[model samples]
Target: MPQLSVIVYGPNTQGHLTELLDSLDAHPLADAEVIVAAVGDWARETAGSHSPETIVVPLPDGTGDAAARAAGAARASGRWLHFVHAKDGLPAGAPRLIVERTAELDAMDTPGALAGPGAPDAPGAPVDVLLFDHVSTTWQTTAAPSGDGRLLAAVGRAGLPLDRSASLLRTAPLLGNRALRAAFWRAHEEEFTTDDEPYAACAALLRAGRVACLNQVAHEKRVLRPESLPPLAPEDRLALIDRYESLLALTEDRRAARTVLYDLMVRDLVRTFARENLPDPVAREFFHRASLAAVRWRPEGHQRPAGLEGVRHSLLEEGAYTRYRAFQAANRTRRAARKALRSRKRQVSVKVRDHQYRRALSRPVDPHLAVFTAYWDRGVACNPAAIAAKLAELAPHIRRVWVVSKENAALLPPGTDHVIPGTRRYWETLAGAKYLTNNVNFPGAVVKRPDTIHLQTHHGTPLKRMGLDQMDHPAAAQGLDFAALLARIDRWDYSVSANSHSTRMWERAYPARYTSLDHGYPRNDVFYTATAADVRAARARLGIAPGRTAVLYAPTHRDYEAGFTPRLDLAALADRLGENTVLLVRAHYFYGGAASPLTGLRRSGRIIDVSSYDPVEELCLAADALVTDYSSIMFDYANLDRPIVVYADDWETYRTTRGVYFDLMAEHPGKVAHSQEELTEIFLTGAWRDESAAKARAAFRRRFCEYDDGRAAERVVRRVFLGEPEEALPPVLPPEERTPAPTPEEATA
Candidate 1:
């Protein structure tokens, strides 16, 4: 018999099924059977393409997920049964880890086992259940680690009686994160007849002989997109009351288990009541039904949880639905009043300085006035700068004023009109401008008028999670107020996207009603427009000697670290690459003003610090190759068709702390090196410019450089500044037809 039977089930049309199956193939188990419960013709067809050893069980049309799961379970023949949904996945090496842990349990002596009373405890007895950790991911959020870790950590690796670890009942709500012994499952098969997995999980926990916790994340649960989820019927929501009653009867004799189960039921009902938007009649009905269950299942001498929750329990026990509604309304009113008071205080604090700005806001917006900023007022650069320059030639009547910080004021062109942040001119310009463009968000204090057009020309293609997606990574979120962020995003009338991938990510992350202008990044237009002379001039400006190789080393910031910390020893790397090569090091903009740590190497003429360099387009034009780790610069550099290397020494750490949209190592532009030694070897061995590297770079360019052509800036200026239709704008040139700027070597040749 196989050690484990993995039963997978989902709707036939589920789009993520292929990803799930592919992950399983990449990380296969040695002694496990896979049973795919194909629910329709499409599912069967897709399953046929997978390994022939996988068992495909066809189900009739219109079958629900629960019935499919039951069918798969009935066909399962292994000693252990594990369930998986087609939209979910198994993490790498998780299957082997799970199988090994369960095998150990089977080999242990049965004496003194924590199996519950009446359990058969002969030698080689099977464990009732083995629980493991999981991650939950949604379209608008990154993967969030399960809270079950703390409870499971306390239970240790040893098997324990259900009563000894009754608190594990909190996690009994999820199904796919646990495995059950086939023998144990057969004994309690009748209890799982219901369609509700939570109810069945509760039943199994109440009756389990012995349970163990696997403290590793073995499953990846994909939360269906909000629009994809079907609304819960009134009957389905009400059925929870019946499930909880049945569970209460099962746990009647077990006091600790009964208390935990009761608390779980009440919490579940409260969450549904608070989160779901039901009609008034249905909501009242649900509240009435829930109040009765709360009163009936109240454990003796039970202490209600503290704060607003305890108050809610008291109201529920009284069966006062009207009073509960009133209480919720009053609380909302109090919160709104407090928020308004805070706003009023802020206004008072800035009233004197902002008086002229307030006056400007009341007046009609100036149709010819426009405002632009980039990198939080660093200087005029990026897509905003490109658009601003084009606007000057295309719509000369429109007055453009840039927002710059006092320190960066000198960096702007001598004749350029600009306003310093926090000054009266800055406030008036922001208030009066009918068109505003920025690469980053303006300060939260700035008011967005309805008549003003806001264009968000994001600086780069997203590799790391952004906007609402950062909610799960606390290090990345850094106490961000999502509500405020959304308010700012709401002001955007247009969001510029570089490619389809970026368009999808931005839509999901920001989730505003703004229209996406899929006209490639304007800043990257330089790649196609620059002449051979331009490339040589960029190289000369950066002090790259003729006939020498220049490698641009740009690394992204780490949210887990306090400040800039170089991951590579630049001196050692430059020495190894020989004096024929020069490194153009650019740190992330987050550490813009910090002193360079590579000053010694810069003095040696081996390293040039371009951390504060304007128009990174110039840096890309000067380099022969690009070396980066998780920086969006790779996406832009691919346009040049240069050899790109990913130096990811701390890839796992970065992926965990600051979640990424995709695995860069798997679909890299060129070669990937995990260590400094490997990186040096790649350059020395001429592998960086090999045929394999060219193929990777070609594929990467096709995907990312889809819309970038010489005319991107013209397209933006025509569509946005000139008020022309998208059809009238210039069409994008295909990659093969477009010519990127020549390298210094090609220019010199």
Candidate 2:
């Protein structure tokens, strides 16, 4: 039989399993075998890439990992077994190290080393199983118990935890006892898996003082597995009770063991209860009773994890849980009632405005123009500002009206005639305007005129599904009527696209007869023309410190979630990046209606809320790096030739619920981080750019920024307003004519 068998769980779609296999192959252990338990046939593809002797077990779809682990253990043909979670791999030296330790544990020379698992009670039989870790370093573990008669009691009294490491164990104990195999399945069936098996198998062996420590690290672990805590199910609760009962019967000191188990189980339950948001009253009551039980029967005083001080206090407090639940129910009811009332009001308002929306068109359509970005009710600036500026300069004779929100009436530039939305003047302008332009869809209420040309300057190059393509998205398409939406899109006389990919996406998705300029985003046109003085001026406006790397952390809004959910912990991020990094945060216009994300922080020098910063182009010019998730702004930022890191912690959820056009994990313009730790590491080590994301950035530029010459605005003006043919546009100026970016020295100065 092979000396080592490695079992891997989860599909290897990310090729994490392949990495483990490569590591094992590089650090060869003679007769070592690999067993992969995966849900799909794709495992076979990964298995094929592994060593010749590797085995692939087709796990039942949706089978719990515990069951999959048991199945892999049964198929293993090794004296010692090593379990691997998918995201974590054995270090290159781990295979050789574990091999050496397992041999040492079985050696006859070692004091109290295992003499195999045969009748462990026999004189000189192995007294303890050796525990080790994957890395060279090991945690505090038991030394060999040589002839220690009270070793069983000592093992329990020591209160050592069997961490979820790639631990080595004798196959004889697992193989010889058919009851142990049954117990493994039984424990998993009872929702008592990792805890139950390790405890049961190790306890039985430790009775004969068979638990030993190699005083070395054996295997690595990562945030690869889903939470193994019991769900809000009756079976899960019973499973916990069953395991507790089983352990109570076996422990040498039931009181002490129960105390320890209760504390640990309560900590796990508290977290699960809060995070799982259990809706079942029966299960919730059961958990409440369990907490009471812990308080009533706990051997020692109670213990709780941090952040659960309130939970612990509530359990000890009289009638607190009841009152809290009642208050939550009442609040939920209040919210529902308010939502219904608001929905009714909206319906009434829509009905009342139906005639007037069309009546506004009765006025003569102004032959000149009006432009708004995003929405009529919105106060923001983006591509529209650049387009508005170019239009003023190129065709000043054409009457221009800036459509801004009432709240933002003061923001209109000096000498620029602006009309507040919803006013009578706004309606007259809407009726009169021969030209209308916006970066997003026009207000649904606005009626399209026959001769008026509406240009849709869509924001961003899409990575996620949008427009008609997102009709299938549950979250993205909630309350959305595709027919009406496409009708509005059809009204567009011209649609501005940032790139060829975007042009194709727009043409396929909209399919309306509209001229697509594909002239690149006007917002990024400055990147091509901005001189060093321009870059310096933008940096000065933003108040960036010398030698500081401005990392703009901009994440896209989730359509499914409500309000501005702060994904990045600002304080933690600031601390992680250190003082030299200034975090320039720009929120989406949807989140809190342009409110800065950094509201309540101590106003530390580290974080800057640049949401109100005029023209994001300046922020891009000033910043050294960008960190974003699922935001198409990455495509825009790539043109700046800066480093970008994708911190897509919820990539799976975002991809499935909202959907994406590409597998960003594989082909994002930057390294896509799955966790804050990895993201921080990348930023701190400067791996977020240059070394990690350079090649992808180049490719991204070619794909998304082909037509983003500084003269995009000029092209839009010449073609749309000046009535010039595409070929009749003036030649793009040489690079020297466009302002050069300030040197690093000048920027710092």
Candidate 3:
């Protein structure tokens, strides 16, 4: 008999299986037998040749992997059987981990704690079953570490389904018991979730013998096609309901029973399987029945929002026949209103564009024009704000009208003629303006006439990938339309670059033939000119306590997650830092949330969320230290010459997924904290301010800080806005020439 039998299932996964078999071949699996449980002859042919013994089983048409798993297991000759999805690859450590964990289970009197009572285990007894975890991999973040794998939760009804991630079982224990095999075969035939195999395996293992699991990762579940789980058909939904209902009937405990029913009703019935899902009368009736069964079981737990009680009450008390037609009518009206809001705004824009266009025709081509930074409505910041201020000093004729977004209009500085974007005034000014300067591109719809001088002053330097490097990368170019992006870039008359790195990146990424102004970033000008008194004043303005050190905790975002996932517990961090520190929580610009602390701790003023504060430069001025992950903000913060603590908990995931230009943890200026505990320890121990870190910061500055000198704004205005030559801007001086020479004796020492 074979030592181990590997049964593989192949579906729409065409190119994935060959690599899986290749990996298995690379690793010596001499004692294993291979079985390709294929839908057709193609998957088996796709597998090519393999070692040990190989068998191909053609599954019945119109069936899922569950049926194939059952059929494959019946024919396997190996004592130990492992089931793998053709789309997933076995991790190198899986075979060894299976043995170690199996040995550990064999030595135990009972299986691991979750195995429960009546477990069949005598010391030295062979393992009946072993389930392992999967490392969830996505194309966006391909490099995440292996250990952060998760098994299906035991709480939700959906949790009962076995994850296609990985499964290993003892053939004899599974095949010996008729009832167990029947239970599995029935569950498999139901063909509900992908985890049906595990659900069935759990049923069989519970009856036949003790079940053991290695929560350790032994395979990769790559999410190459992000939308692989297609919408459930009405039959698919009914199948899921049947599976959950059966599981509910079997579950003896109230909590487990409630959980099973909750998943069926709450997860599907009222949520996904509403009247909208398969609007068929039969499907709707099943959803209602499931909802009624769930509410009768228990209305609470499952961490569902208490507010949803009204919804539950409506469904349970009011019959399914009750039509909330008013809801549909009202939603349609609201949707129409939302769609019309933009049309109404654009009508006003057209009127204003004409007015502004006509008004500018009478007026001379005033170099004094509109300036925007970042998005349309951002306040005076970045290159535009700096350039705008310098223009007023040099030529007072320059009329600077700021275009703001209505939502972010509050952040715009007062005493300026600011027009909300899409407003009549904004459209007029944009159309009429002689010179337009913005860090980001203007609307692609905006026709950049030959007379207009458009300056593209981008926001920051990059260590992570940017622009064209991310053209094909989903994670980097999330929500961006590349053709539209390039169209906007094509409108630019001058593209400002902070350094050679940015220049090269922007030039390649934005292939428009715009003139490149290789001057340093104007945003960093504040760092050079800000005195001690300025820092103190900025701190006072933001309400940082006099004695407390302002620590700016700004973390970079992950592409895979929807928004910011809070890695650090805010309350715990504050407690760790004590009363001597104040934390300014600066989330990435894309995220928004409630004013409450991330930990849901009752509102305390120790940690202030500065994510809304548009001017990060002001935060930098107020801060004594910077704490961040892989954000390019660290590179900017280094110019402040303050302490920097890099807290990169998901470094491996981020590096593997996002692909950074440099190893941040190894090269960062200050202490590199792998966890919140270490970051807190650094602050508590005051090791964030070591002399070595200071020296590292100096080196980092030498490498990245070649361009900035407070005169960057003047250089940009003089060249692009004022029509001066690039050489008119002062040349970037060498470090030795820029700084005062050290004393001869000190230098010699």
- TM-score: the better of candidates 1 and 3: 3
User: Using TM-score as the measure, which candidate wins?
Assistant: 3
- Tell me how candidate 3 scores on lDDT: 0.62
How do the predictions measure up, each by TM-score?
A: 0.55, 0.53, 0.57
In model 3, where is the ten-residue run with the lowest total lDDT?
Answer: 172-181
Q: Tell me the TM-score of model 2.
A: 0.53
In candidate 2, stretches whose alpha carbon ends up further than 4 angstroms from where it belongs are 1-364, 593-597, 730-746
The local lDDT score (0 to 100) that residue 694 gets in candidate 1 is 95
> Per-residue lDDT for 341-371 in model 1, tens only?
9999888858866777788789999999999
Return the TM-score for candidate 3, rounded to 2 decimals. Answer: 0.57
Candidates sorted on TM-score, descending: 3, 1, 2
Query: Considering only N, C-alpha and C atoms within 3 Å, which residue pairs clash in candidate 1?
Result: 115-209
Stretches of model 3 off by over 4 angstroms after superposition: 1-366, 593-605, 730-749
